[model samples]
Target: MSTESPSITGPLHDLTVIDLTQMLAGPYCTMTLADLGADVIKVEPPAGDLTRHMGPHREGDSPEALGGYFQSVNRNKRSVVLDLKTAAGRTALLRLAATADVLVENFSVGVMDRLGLSYETLSAVNPALVYGCVRGFGDPRTGGSPYADWPAFDITAQAMGGLVAITGPGPGRPLKTGPGIGDIFPAALCAVGILAAVHEARRSGRGQFVEVAMYDAVLSLCERIVYQHSYTGAVPQPQGNTHPLLCPFGLFPTKDGLLALAAPSDRHWREFCALIGRPELGHDERYATNTGRVAHADAVRDVVTRWLSSRTTADALAVLGGRVPCGPVNDAAAIFADPHVRERGMLSEVEQPGSPAPVVIAGQPIKLSRTPSAVRHRAPLLDEHRDEILSASSAAGDPRHNTSQGQVQ
Candidate 1:
C-alpha cells in the first residue's frame, strides 16, 4: 500500500482482496468490501478498466481522467495495471493471490481458465483464499446454465430473471427498472458469499469458491411474482404503481407531485380515513377491512385521489407524515434537498482529479458502531499503485513456494 493513500479502518481492515473485476457488477462488489476497510487491490489491464473511458467526467478533466461511472464504485481501493495475457503478468497476479485472503473476478465463464488463473489454480497456490465470482448465467462449478456462453448485461439479466415481466404500467408493456438492479443485486449477494466463505476459511484453514449468477439474483429479487403465479395458477402482470393485493398502497398524484401512501392495515386505514376527512369510510363495511378495501380498490383509490388532488405533496405529508405510511415521491433534486439524507450522510463528497470542487456519490449504507464503513479517498488513477503493490508483494514473499498452503504473512 502507498503511504500517500489514506489509511483504511473497519471490520475488514485485516483482509486483503485481489480484485480482477471491471465494470459495474464486480466493481460494485469489491467497492462494498473496500468500504468496509478491506485492502482491495484492483488489478486492471494495461489499457485500464473500460469504465475509465466512460463519459460524464468532471469539468476540465483530461481524457485520461476517470469518469463518474468508474469513480463512483472504484473508490477506497488501490489500482495496479497488468497485461494478464502475458506470462509475466500472470506470474505477478499469482504472487498477489498468494498473499490475498480473497480473489474476486467477473470475467466471462472461460476467461480465467484461458488466462490460467482459475479458482482451482489459485486455491492450490493459497488454500485459504476465498475465490468469488459474479457471472451472467453462472459458473460451471456452481451449476451449468444453458446460456453460460451467451453474453449478458443488466437488461438481459433483468428480462430473463422475470423482473421485466412484472414491471411497468400495464400488462404486455414491461419496462426495465431505472437502476441496474440486475447487476447491483448480484453484486450484493456475491459480497455476502465472499464474507461467508472468508469466515469459513478462517475456521477450517481452507477456502471455497463463491459464485452468484446475475440471473439467479434477479429471480430471487422478483420472488413475489413467482409465489403469486404459483399460488394463483396465473402469470403475474404489471399492476402499475399499485400492488395486486394491497389497496391504497402505491403512488398517488398530489397537487404539486406524487406521494407513496400505504395504509392497508385496519388501524392505519381508520386513521387515514379520519385524516382525509372521510371518517365514515373507516366504518363502512365495504371499506373497513384490508380484504374489503382490496375488493373496493378503485373506490379507495378514488377517495384518496380526490382528497390529495387539492393538496400539494407537502400539505399531504404534513397530515400523514408519521401517522400514516406516506412519503413524497422524491426525485434527485428532492432527495438532495431532503433533511433525512443530509442528517444520515447518505451522500459523500470526494476530491476529483483536476477539479477544485469535490464530486458527490452515494455513501455506504451499512453502519457499524465500532467499525463504520467509509470512503477514505477518491478512486485511484490507472496503474496508480503498481510499483507499491509489486514491491509489497515482493517483500511479503510468494506463499506458493512455502511448505504451508494459504498461509498469509
Candidate 2:
C-alpha cells in the first residue's frame, strides 16, 4: 500500500453485514454500509460477481479481477464464494445469516425463496436481522405487473419510470441520463431504507423487511412531471437542460465555457440585470416583470449571452455571483481542481487492499457535527476476513458441529 493511503476508521465500527446481492443495486447499498464501517461479506456465486469482468478494465489480462466500475462501488467488502444451489452452501449461508445484522439481495422475485433464503425464512432464524431487497419492480404481492418476472437494467427502469420521456431537447428524442440513475439512485434509497430499518430494529428488538424498486425510485426522481402533466393536461416533452416553467434557469454559454444561472425570483432577475450591466432590462416594459421576462425569455437570454460573451467565465462569475445565483458548469477535472472542493474535503485517497499505489476517489459529502461517517477500509479481498469471522462461531460448537476446523463446511 502507498504511504498516502488513509487509515481505516469510522463510527459504524463493528456492524456485520451479509451481502447476497450482486451487480449494482445490492453491491452499492452494501458499499455504503461498508463505508460506514460494517463488515460486509460479498457472497458471490461460484462463477463470481458479473461485474468482475465488466469493463473499463485496468489491463486486459491483469491479476486484478476488478473493473473500474466494480472498484468504484465495491470498496470495503470481503468476498465469499457460495454455491447457493448446493445444500451445504445453503446451510453455510444460513449459518452466516444467523449472525448477520443485515442481509441485502437483488435476485429475481422468487429466486431467494427457491434458494431457501427468503426474508421470512431467514427472519425465523435471526429475528433481529434487517433484510433488504431491491427488485426491478414492486413485489408481486404488492400489485406489480404481470411482467414482474422479466429482467430489468438501468435503461429499462428509466424508460418504464417516465424519466426518459422528458429528458432531452425535442419531443421525439428523449435521452437517458449518462449514469445508471435507475440502478444507482434506487440502490441508495434502498440502503437508506435498510439503515432506517436497522435503526428501528436496534430500538425495538425486531428487524423488518426493507424493499425498494428501481421503477418506483426513478418515478420519485421525476415526480414533478406528474404535477406538470396533471395541471395542464399536457405531457411534458423533452426540453434538454432548460426547465419549461422557469426562465433562464438552465445552461448558458460564457466566453470560454458554459455556466448555469438561476434568476428564479423577481428580485434575482433585477439583480441579474444590474450585474450583467443591463439595468435597463429591469425597466423595459416588455421585460420589467417576471411574467414579462418569461414571455421575452429569448430576448432576455440573448441580452445576457451578449454580456457574457465579452467576458471570460471567471470574470462573468465574479460579476454575477453575489448579485444573482450562478455557477460555472465544471467538468470532472475542474471539479477536482477547484479550491472549494479542496476546502470541503470532497475527495480522498485510499490504497486498494493488494495494490501498491493509492487511488483517488470522491469522498463523503455529508458532514455531521458528531458521529460523522467515514471510509473505514479499502475494499476487502474475496473472503479476506472469513477466517476471522467464522473462528469464534466454529469454536462455540453449534448444533451441527461436525466441521473439523474453523472453516465453514
Candidate 3:
C-alpha cells in the first residue's frame, strides 16, 4: 500500500462511500463524491476494475500502470480487492457497510442479491446506510420496464432515450454525440440522488434505495423534444446545426473554422445585422420577428452564411464577440489554449505510477468559498489499501457482531 495519505478536504469529508462499480456510469458517480471529499473505498474484484486494462497509457508506463479511463474517474479513492463470490468476501463487505455512510453499485439487476449482499441484507446491519444503484432500465423497486434485464451501454442509452432521434443533419441520418452523455448524465443524476438520500438518512435515521436508470436519465436530458412534440404535434427530426424554432442560432462556417452565433431575439438580431454590414435586414418585416425569421430560415441562413464565409473565425469574433451571442466552435486544442480555462483551474495534474512525470486530468468544476473541492491524489493501485482498511475495521469492532443475526426486514 502507498504511504501517502489523500489530502482531500471538503464539505463531504465526514462521509464514507463504498464503491462497488466498474465501468463509466457508476465509477463516475462515485468519482464526483470522492472529489467532494468523501472517503471513497473502491471495492474491486480480485482481477481489479476492468478499466485498469483500458488504454491510452502514458509513455514508458509499465503494464500495471493505470490507463487514462481509470485515472480520469477513480482518483482520490482507496482500492480494496474483494472476491464477492466467496463467503469471506461477503462478510468483509458487510463489515465495511456497517461503518459506511453510503454504498453504490452498477451491477445488473440481481447480481447483488445473488451474491447475498442486497440492500435489504446490508441495511439489516446498518439501518442508516444509503444504497444507490445505476442500471440500464432500473430495478424492480422502481417502475418495471420491459427492458429491465437487458444490458446497455452509452450508445444504447442514447438511442433509446431519444437523443439519437433528434440528432444529426436530417430525419434519416441520426448520430450519437461525440461524448458519452448517456453514461455521464446518469452518473451525475445518480450522484445527486445519493446525496439526497444521504441527507434524508442523516435527518430521519433511516436510509432508502436510490436508483437512476440510464434510459430515464437520458430521456430527462432530451426533455425539450418531449414538450415540443406534445405541444406542436410534430415528431422532431434532426434539423442539422440549426434549431427548429430559433433562426440564426446554430453553427456557421467562417473562413478558417466554424463558429456558433445566436442572434435570434429581435434586439440581438438588430445588433447582429448592424455589425454584419446589413442593418437593412434588421428592419425587414420578413426577418424582424423570430417567428418571421423561422418562416424564412433558408434566406436568413443564406445571408448569415455569406457574411461569415468571408471572415476568419478570429475576425468574426473580433467584430461580434461580446456584442452578440457568438463564439468560435472550440476544439480540444483550442480549449487547452483558452485563457479562461487556465484562469478557472479546469485542469489538474496527478502523479503517475510508472512514469517520472505527472499526468493532467480535468479539475473539479464546483466551487465553494469555505470548503472547496480538489483532486488531492492519483487513483490508487489495485488493492493498495487492504491492510489499513482491515486494521481500522478490526479496531472498531465488527458492527455485524452487535447486530441481530444480520436478518433483513
Model 1 misplacement above 4 A: 1-8, 403-405
Per-residue accuracy of model 3 over 1-409 as CA lDDT, tens digit each: 1222355478899899999999999999999999899999999999999999888887788776788999989998999998999988988898888888899999999999999999998888888888998999999988899999999999999999999999999989999999899999999999999999898888877888999999999999999999999999889999899999899899999898898999899999999999989999999999999999999999999999999999999999999999999998888888878888777767777888878777778877888788878788899999999999877766766766765322233
TM-score for each candidate, following the candidate numbering:
0.96, 0.89, 0.95
TM-score of 1: 0.96
| Residue 20 shift from truth in candidate 1, angstroms | 0.7
Instruction: Please name the candidate that would achieve the greatest TM-score relative to the true structure.
Output: 1
Candidate 3 Cα errors over 4 Å, as ranges? 1-8, 403-409
Question: What are the C-alpha RMSDs, in order, of all predicted structures?
Answer: 2.6, 4.2, 3.2
**What C-alpha lDDT values do all the predictions have?**
0.89, 0.76, 0.89
Residue range 1-409, candidate 1, lDDT tens digits: 1111255478999999999998899999999999999999999998899998886876676565667899889999899998999988998898898878999999999999999999888888888899999999999999988999987899999999999999999999999999999999999999999999898888888889999999999999999988988899889988799988888799999998899999989999999999988899999999999999999999999999999989999999999989999998888888888888876767788878767667777888888888878878889999999899999888867656852545643
- Model 2 Cα lDDT, one tens digit per residue, 1-409: 1122235555565677888888888888888887777778888887777887776644433465455666667777787777899997887787777777788989989999888778887777777888898899867744667668888899988998899998887899999988889998899999899889887887777788888888999999999888988898888889776767777778788888888887867788888887766787777888777677778888878887888887888998888877788898888898888888777666666565445655655656556555555554455555656676566445544524432221211
Q: Please rank every candidate by lDDT, starting with the best.
A: 3, 1, 2
Worst 10 residues of 1 by lDDT: 1-10
